[model samples]
Structures are given as C-alpha cells and as structure tokens.
Target: MKNYDVVIVGACTAGTYFAHLLAKEGLKVLVIDKDSEQNLCKRLDIFHFTRDSYDQFDIPVSGDGDAEWVHDFDLCLSKSALDNHPKKSHTKVAVMHLPLFIKRLRERAISAGVEFHFEESFVDVVYNDQKQVCGITTTKGYYDARLVVDASGIPSVVRRKIEDDYIESFEITPRDKFYVLLKYVQLNNPDDKVELSTSWPYYKGWIAPQHNKSGAIIGVGANISYDYAYKCMDKFEKAIKLPEYTLQYEEKGCTPYCRPPLSFVTDGFMVIGDAACLTKPWNGEGIPSAWVQCTPAAKVVAKALSDGKIATKEDLWDINVLYQRGEGAEYAGTRAMLIGAVNMSAKDNDYLFANDIVFCDDDKGPNPNVVGTLLKGVFSGKFSLGGLISLMSASNKGEKLKKHYQKYPESPAGYHKWAKTALKLWKKVGTMADTVKDA
Candidate 1:
C-alpha cells in the first residue's frame, strides 16, 4: 500500500488548493480525481473570480496574456423584477476558463510536493479497528493515510460513504441544490455587447461577459431541477427587456444550496468545499468560501498531525469552532433572511427596491428604520401583511441562529448539546428551497 500523510478526493479548485496549502505545511499529500487532467473542471468553460481574492488567498493572478485569463470587469449590477432600481456594486473580477484555472492550481500543488493521480475514483473509506477513517479505497487500489479529506464537490463520494456519528451522510437532495443553466450567446447588435455582470434577483438570473467580445453568458439558478431553472429564465426574459442575442451553446451545473453539516471533522477525517456545502448563501459561489474554512483547517490539521500524533475529533474540533463562529454564523443569518425576503410578490419586491430596503446598494449600510419603513409600506398597501410577518419572523429566527452559532462549543465535550440547539434553530430558520414557487 502507498502511504501518505493525507489523501484528498476530488482534484478540482478546492482539492488542489487545499493540497497545496497542506503540502506546504510539510505533509505528504496525494489528490485523486475520477476525470483525467484534460477533462477536469470542463463542466463550466468560463467562471469569474474576484480580483482581490487572489491576493487574499495568496493565489497567483492570471494576467491578460495568460491562457486562463479572459478579461476583467469592475461592476456588478442588480435590478428589480421591473428592471427598475438598479443597484450597483464595484469589485474587479477576473473571467477565466475553469479547466485552465484548475490546471494552474494543479501545477502549484505539484510544486508544493503534492502527488496527483487522475482517473482514480473513490470506492469507499478504509477504517481502523476503532472505526476511525484511516485511508481510502479507489478504483485503482488502496492507499493508506493518516488523514482523509473529501473535497469531492456535490457528489461527496468519500463523505457519503462514511457512516459515523459525527458526520452527517445525508445526500444533497434536488431541493437542497441550485441547478444553474448557462447560455452562451452572441449579441445581435455590436453596440449592445455585455461588458459587466448584471443580475435580476427576482429571477435568480444574470447576464455576464464571455471570452468572446461580442458574446455573453446568461445564467439562471433555481431549486428542483434544470427544467425549473429554464422556466425561471423564460419568466425573466418576458418580464424584462434584454439585448437580442443568438445562442451559441449551453452548459449546466449544480451547487449545494443548503446549510452545511454542523460538524466538518471527525477522527482522522475532514470534509471541505462543496462536499461540506461551503458556498455563499447570496451567490452560491463555493471557491473563496471553501478557502475560508481551509485556511484555519490547514493550521489545525498540521498541528494535530505534528510529531506523528494521531488526529482525533478532539484535536480537530478547533476547525469547527473557528469557522462556525465566524463566516458560518454570518451565512446562517443571511441564508435565513433571504428565504423570506425572496418570497414576496413582484410588486412588493419593486417597492422594496424603490425604498432601498433589502436589495439596496447604499454605501452607508443598512437603514436604521427598516422596521418602520416596512410598517409604512404595510400601511400604504405597498406590501402585504402576511409578507411582512413572514419577513420579520425569518429575520428574528436568523438573528437567533447567528447568536447561537457565535457561541459554538470549543471542544467535543460540549458539541452534542450545541448541535441539538442548532438543529432546532435551523429548523425554524428554514431553507432557500422553501422559497421555490410551484411550477
């Protein structure tokens, strides 16, 4: 058996980045993927990465001449259902080819001393006498490792195979996922070329610049399935005016939209990236968010594995604390609030946009009299009473969940009690899937 310090399944963005970080910590890391190197990350040809994230994560920036680089845009605009009340936000973003970007990440990981084995699919996890995960069985053969990390995206191959009390093996159901469909289209009018990303939150749709100067990508994500997403796109196009374009091609993908497992670690095992549902509640972007967990996790895992000490749940508990108290808490509240916020009528949505409420881009911050404004809207008949009540209830529940997460347990001894309360709170907070309207 080939022995390694850590065996990571899935060699995409999350796996390669984590492997590079861990290998830099002087651990022997090995990454395996079911797809060949040429085929990895080919599902999506083009994707966006915030320019500042490269510096924040210490990642190499792809320049204009680089194979991965397409172009950069500085503004993202969000509009109401009626196409009024456009909210503009500024952040430079790099457009890149996904497969080439993954190739770049892989090269970095290799330079950091991580081994890569393409075309090796995970079969199952190998457990020790104590029932702790010790290695993994792949289609090719068995490999022994002290730590096993699952960055296996949505399928969560390795994580789903683990039957442990600490780990939740629940499958990410259709309702718990965002099915995204992207249409690559060429603008009919040369003057109407897409230059920046623009989104309509009501439709969960956006049109962004593509690699070709005259081409753009129109995308929509919805619960249930790709068919539902297409239905949403049809509604969006009818409700708002868009530049005429000729369709070139289409691509589809899915991202986990549900809350992540409360615990991301167990004895000699950890799960990160999409496998752990580490995505932004607002946008369904997983790369930077997953790295947020990976930064602290690498430190904790490195320390636990130092001096050849066997890593246990007790030793890995800090990873949960660090994340749950920080980004996890923030996302919990935002996710909860969004469920109710998006459930309003199109007229009420336009009213909120006009009043600079939830969809506002005010640089000053949230309006202090938000409740008063909602009450005013209710009195003016601009908003429904039931909608107001639902929004308030969801906001209150979100705040409570955030507070509870901030008090995350510091050790395994206090975990079960904390988790029990968290589950109850999340049940009340609800999910984005709850906002899906009947087709």
Candidate 2:
C-alpha cells in the first residue's frame, strides 16, 4: 500500500487547506477528491471571507478579492420599529471568487510537494489491530497513512464509518439544512453593494456585487426543499424589483445550518470542516469557519507529529479543547440563541425585529448573541420589560452552553461524562424551524 504522513479523504477547502499547511511544514501529505480537477468547487455561492482572515492564513489574494475593500451591507426587516424596524450594520466583510481561491490553494499545496488524487471516492477506513485508524481504501485503490482526516463535507463518510465505540458521531438532520439558490444577473440598480433581509425561520435573500461589476449575484436561502427555495428566489427577485436582469449563471445547493460537534477527535483520526458542522450561526456561511476550525487542527496535528508521535486520541484531544474554548464555544451558544429567537411566536419575533432586538446585523459579522448591544437596543427602542426578559433569557441559555463547551474534557478520561452533560443541556436548546414559514 502507498503511504504518507496524512491521508485526507476529501480535498475541499478544509482538507486541501490543512493538507497544504502540513506539507509546508515538510510533512508528506496526500489529498483525494471524488470530483475532477477542472470541476473542483463547482458549487458556487455569493460568499465573502474576511480580509483579516486572508492575511491571518497568509493565502495570497488575487482578482476581485484584491479590488477595493468594500463593507456596504444594508439589512432590511420584514417589520418596522414603531411604524418602523431595526437594522443592523456589519463590519470587516469582503468578497472573493471561491473557485479561483480554492484553485490557488490546491496549486500552493502541490507546490509544497503534496500528492493529489482526484476523481477517487472514499470507500472505507482501514484499521490497525488496536482499533486505530491506519489508512483508508478509496475507489481508486488502497493506501496507508499514519493519520486519516475526514473532510468530506456534511456527509462525513469516514465519520459515518466509525463503529460508534469511539467518538460519538455528529449527524445533520433535514432540519439542519438550508436549501439555497444563487444566480449571477445583470443588474439595473446603480448601487454597487450587497444586502440581505429576511424574516425568521422562513425567507432570506441577498445581493452581492460581482467582481466584474457588470452585474451582481443575488440569492435566496430557505428552510424548505430545493424546489421551494427555487421558487422562493422568484419572490426575492420580485421583492427587490430586480429590473429584468439577465441570468448569466445559477447554482442550487444546500448548506448544513447546524452547530459543530462538541468533540470530533479520536485516536489516529480527525474530522473537520463541514463534516464537523462549523458554519457560522447567522448566515450559515461555511468558508470562514472552515478555515478557522481547520487552522487550529493543523497546528495541533503539526505539534503532535513534531514529537515523532502518532496522533492518538489523547494527542489530538487538544483540538476539541481549544476549539470549544474558542470558535466552537461561541458557535454553540450563538446557534442556541438564534434557534431560540426563530422559534419565538411570530408576534414576538416581529416585535423583536421591529425594535431591532435581534438579527439586526449581517450573519457574517462578529458574535450572533450581542447581549449588551441587544439589551441597550431593547431598553431604548421598545422599553418593554417582557422584551428585556426575553433577550436576557436567550442570553442566559447561550452562556450556559458556552460554559459547558469550555469544560470539554482534557482527554478521553472524562469525555463520556462531559458529552452526556453537554447533550442533556443541548436537548433543551434547539429550534422549531421545522414548523415555520413566511408568515
């Protein structure tokens, strides 16, 4: 069997990005993808990753990402703040051509002497006698690796194959997906900016200016089926008076709109990116969180190997601990807080939004649960004690989940007890979006 220091089962952003990081550190890396080279990153979205993040990762920026920095985000509400509604502005947001960005990453990885295998789907996980992951068998063939990483998006093929005796698998249900449609169109609006507006648990739409500036890419994100979301786009097009723009191209897909697992590490294996459910809480953006989550993973894996040690569960446990204390913790709390908001009665939601109490900012912006700002906004605009209490209650639940996440066990020694407690707490913190629609 061919061997390498690492075998990444999915060569998407998380897998390839992390593979490049490792290879740059002088590690032997192998990245495999089921899709062909030309069609990589085929699913396109009108998404923007942060400028700060690009510099943080040291990934070179080319094309429109190199254009003038723009942060003009206009958020409209379905309801009004008196006879009006509250609006939230965003910060530190920018756009990039995703397929090109990924291609650059892939090429950079290849330059670092990393091996690439495309059009080969993962078949199964190979294991050693001690029940540790030793390698993986792909549709193309079999290869051995010291560590196996599952970056195969939400399906998480390698994670699904885990016998359940190891780490508890995190699965995405139907309720955890957002059926989305994005289209590039020739616009008539002279304004060269993007905007997103929606009502909770129902309809959301956005418009992002294309790099060429000839037109823009507008999209609809919905909690319904692909067909329903497809139809919803027509409504969004009508909502904005989309000016009979010609459709240049379009993409319809789904994103996992769920919180990541409390822990996703085990002996000789790691699961990351969408497979770990690291999308941002507000807009369900996956790119930034994928990079954020995987950066720490690369560092942890690098350190684990630096000592000439195999990445056992204990060695990799820090990945969970650090993320829980950082991005994972914030994401879990934000998710609960958001689900709490969406599950509110429409009247309550209308009151909150009309008062600018929640969902006032772009989803890609900072924290979703902005307790102090929300408290002030409620105090000044609505001045209703019930509103104040509702905001506080959501804040409290978010804090509780964050605390639980901070207490993630140092090793497998206390994982069961910790995981049990975390699950019990999460059971109290989901949404009723399954029943919501544009009302």
Candidate 3:
C-alpha cells in the first residue's frame, strides 16, 4: 500500500493548483486522472473571467486574490498561430485552451515534486476505524493517506459512494443546465470582431475568436426545461449558421447547479471544484471559483493534517463564508444593475449602448466588452441601469431598480426565503406568459 500526506483526484485547474501549492509546502501529494489526454478535456474555445469583484455572472470568479498560484505556460510551435487567432476587439480577454492549460499545470506539478498517477480511476476510499479518511482505492491499487481531496469535476465517485448519511444539507431540487459549442471557419473580413448577441426568447449566444481566426460559438439554455434543452441543442446549430470550415471539436454538457450536500467533508476526506457543487447560481462558471476555493482548501487541508486536527464541515464553512462574502457582494451589485435596466425606456437603451462603446475602449479588465458588461451589470443589478437610461430618457428607473435590488435579504435565512419567493414569481410569470400566448 502506498501512503502519502494527501491524494487528489482530477488534475484540472483546481486539482493542479492544489497539488502545486501543497507540494511547495513539502507535503507529499499524489494526483490521479482517468486519462492523460493530449487534448481530451480541452474546450476548443476561448474563455475569459470577469474581475474577482464581479460575481453576478454564472462563470465563477473568486473575490479572493491573495492566494499564491502559478500557471504552466508554453509557447505554441505554430508560426501562423497569431495570424489565425480570433480577434478580441470586443473584449481584450485572454483566450484559453483547456487541454493546453491542464497540460501546463501537470508539468508545473511535476516540477514542484508532485507525483502524477494518470489513467487511474478511483474505485473507493479507505477510512480509518474512527471513520476518518485514510486514503483511496484505485483500479490499480490502494493508496493510503491522511487526507483525500476529490477534484473530480462533475461526477464524483467518492462523493457518490459515501453513505447518504454522510451527506450534509443538499439542494433537493436538481438543475440541469445545457450548452452546445461549435467551431466554425474564420470570416474573410479580418477587421470584423467576434460579437455575442442576446435574444429575448431563447438563450444568448457567444462567439469566441480562436487561433487561426476561427470562431468558437456556444449557446447555453439554462432557464429552459431539460427537455427544452435537448431541443435547443439541435436547434442551436441551425440557429447559428456556421461558415464553411473544418470542425475541430464539439462539447456538450449539462451541469447541476443546485446547492450541493452539506457533507462535503468527512473525518478523512474532502471534495472540491464541480464535485463539491461550487458553481454559481446565475451563470454556470465554476473554474475560476474552483481556483479560488482550492487555495484556502489546500491550506486548511495541510494545516489539519499537520496539526492533528480532523477536518470538519465547520472548517469548510469558514472558507465558504469568506468566498460568499466577497462573491455575494458582487452578486448583490449585479442584481442592482439589472433591475435598473429592466425598467429602462427604449431611448435610454440606445444611450447605454453608446456609452458602452466608450467604456469598452477605456476599462482594462476581463469584463465583457463594454456593452455586454453594462447590460449584464444592469440585469445583475451591479451597475446603474437608470443611469444608462438617464443619458437619454432622464428617468429614475435605475433608482427604482436599486431599491428592489436592495430588498434582496442579505442573511442566509433571508436569502433562502427570497430565493424561494423569487422562484414562485418566476413560475407565475412563466404561466402568465404562456396563457397570454395561447389567448
């Protein structure tokens, strides 16, 4: 039996970051993944994260920026890479290839003295007599350790195998958010920048410019029912016309966004990333938040083992409290902005668009190009929607929206109650809209 200080499953962003950090601290760490895919989990797309301060958008961004972290980077060998790359005139955010990023992280871990055990699937976990985590059982063999960190992205076998009694409070309702992304040929007009267009009836669509000037277009339909999502996936391809180009890759996935079970940690084990239900409520971004969570998690896990303290839910909650505080403030701000926009007049919308262009040019951040961020901010209640309208209509709609956004209860009890009521409102509005259409 092999034993170590810690064992982490899944070598993606969170796993990689944790392994690197723990290894640097001189803790023996072992990382396992199902495969050493050259380009396996790569999204074949470009991605950007908004500032840590903005949490309203679903893609997770950590408000905690104090953690020391590193990325594995390598220069692409292709000379035409720059020429073929997609234009981010819309937002000067960096393009990311997931596979490449993962590979780099793997190399970084190796350099930091973390051991890699690829192509290994975790079959079970070994618990000490006291019900503390002792290690893990893999298809290859059983490895013993003081702690186990489950970073297995979406489906966590360890989490699943643990008795339901081990589970803490979990969101009972299951939510499946689906999305489809495609790679299309680059347009002849090099001057044209990629744009994300929003639709009122369906989900909004995003187009990311990639290397070779090709575009990766994706559409997510979360509000629609699961059955509706399947329809949207098929319909989306037709809805977004693809230019003649060789298809490089296609990714389809459904995420469960409901709160995860409270028992994320047992006496001897812990879970992180998607497996731990760290996804945001409004949008489905988990990577950035996972990165943020991993830092504190790694630190705490190390401390617990070194200090002879058993890890518990309270420790996890301590981290969650900090994350929620920073992320919560941003969510509150976004809600304030969005409420203002929903109340805006048509004329004000136009003014907001123009002003967005100016902000797009000035702000140096990962926020969506100005217009999209402004619109998102309005919808999220972060920015002043009425202020945007004021540039044209001089209405106080922004103030009204601010008041409503402020009404969001800040306490845990208050938020839960508010969320429940809001869901009811959504259900009511959906029913009314359907009835009106039928009439």
The most accurate candidate by TM-score is: 1
lDDT of 2 at 196: 41
TM per candidate comes to: 0.98, 0.83, 0.61
Best by lDDT: 1
* Cα lDDT over the full model 2: 0.71
Q: Model 3 over residues 251-348: C-alpha lDDT tens digits?
A: 55544454444335656677777777666533456776666666666666667667655455444444444444454334433333433332344344
Model 1 residue 180 CA deviation in Å: 0.3
Per-residue lDDT tens digits for candidate 1, residues 3-83, read 998999999989999999999999999999999988998988899999999998999989878999999999998898788
- Candidate order (lDDT): 1, 2, 3
Instruction: Sort every candidate by TM-score, greatest first.
Output: 1, 2, 3
- Point out the higher-scoring one by TM-score: 1 or 3: 1
What overall lDDT, based on C-alpha atoms, would model 1 receive against the true structure? 0.90
Candidate 1, residue 60: Cα displacement in angstroms equals 0.6
TM-score between model 2 and native:
0.83
In candidate 2, what residue range of length 10 has the lowest lDDT sum? 75-84
lDDT of 2 by residue, 260-332 (tens): 7667888778888888888887777787787876777787888777765568888888888888888888888
On TM-score, the stronger of 1 and 2 is 1
